[model samples]
Target: MVIAVVADIVGSRKLDDRTSAQRILDETIARVEADLPLAQQPLTPTVGDEQQGVYRALDDALVSLLMIQLRLPDGIAFRFGIGIGAVSAVESVHGELADGPGWYAARAAIDTVHAKEGRAVPGARTWIVGAPGQDEVMPSTIAASNAYLLVRDELVGAMSERERRLTYGRLIGRSQQELAADEGISQPSVSKSLRSAGSAALLDGVAALRGDSA
Candidate 1:
């Protein structure tokens, strides 16, 4: 099976003030390219704020999306539309292709994500578009999205001030030691609270939200 991914940076206009958005676009594309399992898979060009690429496996494509979402810089987010189907043709290095069910499915997925206001995660946050005979894939994506949203809501609803600090710190890539120093807490303490709040487990839940199994 072939899977196509289209990812766009949210709020591109705001980011334009910083560095013309080229650096961020390049960074996002590079990040996805590096994460692809198959070294031979071609990385397509970016059109303005959007980037597109293809993979031979649905699992690999899904993993690439998750990796990009997790690694994006703060104040910057992404919306992804994934379509899985058969490919009739792939134009060499460019990844351009003739219209087919796969292309239609991808367009549907993009519409779904846009309808959700670019929230491409589990629960109500992300929307998934699927094609015919995709029974196994669709349900899993939906279930995972739901589970992730549940965890996110729970954490945000109940976390204390200190807990919130540590959680955001980790989510935004701060090391436990750094968060500890900033918060005047021990590294162990930071880890403990994070674990107790199920932050790491929650991340696992979100990652699990993708794939053919929920």
Candidate 2:
């Protein structure tokens, strides 16, 4: 089956510069495996705040995103992007990972998400290289697109424009210092805004939008 791949960070630069980000990443991976075992997927942790994984079905993938949004701890949030395509091999040799048009498509999706402007939220953006028979086989893609629309609105309602811009800056690989410079503010001011804006409430709003109890 053609599947969608998602990569994300549980906390952006808001995490301490030290080892806490890695611990958070590990915790995020464990949560994914525990919460959605049926997806039967593996996630590769990249850098301190990022992780990559694949899903065999769009519904499972979207559900996983929702779960991540709902479960993140206070002072932590996530920004993610997804790609959809077909792969010849679901699981490959230990050292030789899956790499093909599907993998490339997935990377493209991540790139698209990374290119987005402000904080990354569910359905911030996605890339899809239609696999053979993909249009006919994956009706859920349409549903997922609709779901993303809802997610976007929910995120916007939960966060202000300033918050979104800061989040977007981080997603595009801008460091906290860089974002501060770009906004003509000190790094501490940026940090203060993010904390004062209430990350937990934003996440709760996201969960509510997904029809989950916050």
Candidate 3:
């Protein structure tokens, strides 16, 4: 099974300097692709302000989504759609041309997120799609994933810039001590930031999402 991820900037068209958003997005894509074990087809830009990529594992995709979400500047939020299905086409020579059931589902997922955003759903960011009717396990998993994403996105969005940096560092496995040094704050202050921002709860959500929670 292949997992397809489709992502777009939330307000690219409104940006006074559109290129800045694109540059940041490109850098984010590069960072994610380099860090994750992607499928043979790496992330490639699509029409407008969107990009798509394939991942071998759902957890990897989730990590990439959170990383990108936190890294984007305040004006450039992201919406992600993850699809789990078959990839009928993948072009090594032209990664952007890849298409299949997975791609279509990812497309649908993004549209769903966009619709939710229009309805003023708070932190409607990450979404997933799969063939639903016949697949019991997959549907249940998707539901749980959505539940986790709802809280995760909202918590991240609510964080201050300092809190966000601390949370991102934590997500990437940086110790609180290291984060304190990075931020020029005491270790106790780092713990306080994590507590106040609900970063610890976010980590618990991530653990649940990745099936690591007991």
Return the top candidate by TM-score: 3
Question: Tens-digit lDDT track for model 3 on 1-214?
Answer: 6789888878777889888778878887677566544444556677888887888777768766787777666777779988988877656865636677888889899999889878878578989998433266788878888887877888888888888778878876789999999889999999999999998887776676567789
Looking at candidate 1, the ten consecutive residues that score lowest on lDDT are 118-127
Question: What tens digits encode model 2's per-residue C-alpha lDDT throughout 97-141?
Answer: 565565666666566555553455443544444444556646575
Best by the lDDT measure = 3
C-alpha RMSD (angstroms) for model 3: 2.7
Model 3 TM-score relative to the real fold:
0.87
lDDT of 3: 0.79
Q: Which one wins by TM-score: 2 or 3?
A: 3
The local distance difference test score of each candidate is 0.59, 0.56, 0.79
Off by over 4 Å in 3: 33-42, 90-96, 132-134, 210-214
- Give a tens-digit lDDT track for model 1, residues 89-193: 657686755456665677677666566553543222233445677667666865675355444544544555577556656744579999999989899999999
> Which RMSD values do the candidates have, in order?
6.1, 10.9, 2.7
List ranges where model 2 is wrong by over 4 Å. 10-14, 46-49, 88-94, 118-133, 137-153, 156-214
What are the TM-scores, per candidate, against the unseen true structure?
A: 0.61, 0.55, 0.87
Candidates sorted by TM-score, best first = 3, 1, 2
Q: What is the lDDT of candidate 2?
A: 0.56
Model 1: runs farther than 4 Å from truth? 18-20, 32-43, 90-98, 118-126, 133-186, 189-198, 206-214
